[model samples]
Target: MLLCGLAAVVSACGEPAPRKTGGTGTARPGDRVTAASAVPVNGGVLVDLPGNAQLLVVQPRPGEFRAFNPSCPHVGSLVNPPAGGVITCPLHGSTFDPASGAVRKGPAASGLAEVAITLSGEDLVLA
Candidate 1:
């Protein structure tokens, strides 16, 4: 149908306007987490924030950290944190890379959404 085509075109064009920088249904910012508790050498660590924002924090390399909103681009379902660096959405089969928030597979046309993070001393603050 024409409606379906139009919807596909819109989604393929680009992402929706950036959601307010907070978590699900909230305008306030997220909380800070300790870096030592988040970044791991093997897989990722899931940190649940205020307003129901779940973040996956990964240590891709020594001294490097990355963070992403663990929500599937397809249906906004919560994505499983990476195991051996692969993030998977259980609701579907979409996969993402935690380090770069890049899409590793489809049914999800885009990557995972990045969450702002900054390091302060030994902690990572959700900005």
Candidate 2:
């Protein structure tokens, strides 16, 4: 019983069910994004993740922000950022609310992994 319990915890610790985009650095509470403070808003920003991963800043939600990975979690495919602020998996048609990358469909039980993010004076940091 002890071994079984330990195994279960370890398995769950490495990662949660893949969301539309999360698998690397995630933005938990108390995190913030930083930049030059005078760059062009048009370009926005990009953040690096482990495993050759990267996330791009697309939208801002004030106290929160949204980011999309060039990869998809449903089938190791690529995922697209939200349409009208809703993230969706292009591989399996799973949709997530960027504000809270939670699953909004079947074939997907996990929410999108959070990419680090912060609001720097009206700019959404893709941290």
Candidate 3:
């Protein structure tokens, strides 16, 4: 019974579903994201873009925004948002920088992929 319980916990924290790589590093050009819609707090908000791509937008400094693909490079797991500003992969303990998307710990050798975006009229647009 204990073994079965452990397996359940492991499976519950398994890797994410496979992602389609159509637009991995880029958001759709001209797509508008309102600031109020994505209130930046610890870890940042998960934004779902067209084509099933996921983005993590973190404002480390006031009025400064950084965006990155939230997928863990080690095994395609969807990295969880920052807890105390540290982005971590729930599956295998990989960690990344929420601001610069740099690799902080392993299992993931590479950092998260950056996604370019620009500010316009209180909204962030894909660049």
| lDDT value for model 2 | 0.54
List runs of model 3 lying over 4 Å from the truth: 1-27, 34-37
**Each candidate: how many clashes?**
0, 3, 1
| Clashing residue pairs, backbone N/CA/C < 3 A, model 3 | 43-82
| Candidate 1 TM-score over all chains jointly | 0.71
Q: Residue 59: error of model 2 in Å?
A: 3.5
How much is the lDDT of residue 10 in candidate 3?
94
Best by lDDT: 3
Structural similarity to truth (TM-score) of each candidate: 0.71, 0.48, 0.74
Q: Tens-digit lDDT track for model 3 on 49-87?
A: 666766777777677887777778998888877787798
Model 2 C-alpha lDDT per residue in residues 23-81, reported as the tens digit of each score: 34554344344443422222323455444445644444433345555454566565564
Q: What TM-score should be assigned to candidate 2?
A: 0.48
Distance (Å) between predicted and true CA of 10, model 3?
28
List candidate 2 stretches off by more than 4 Å. 1-51, 56-60, 66-71, 119-127
Clashing pairs in 1: none
Candidate 2 pairs with clashing backbones: 22-113, 72-77, 82-86
Which model, 2 or 3, shows the larger lDDT? Answer: 3
lDDT of 1 at 66: 73
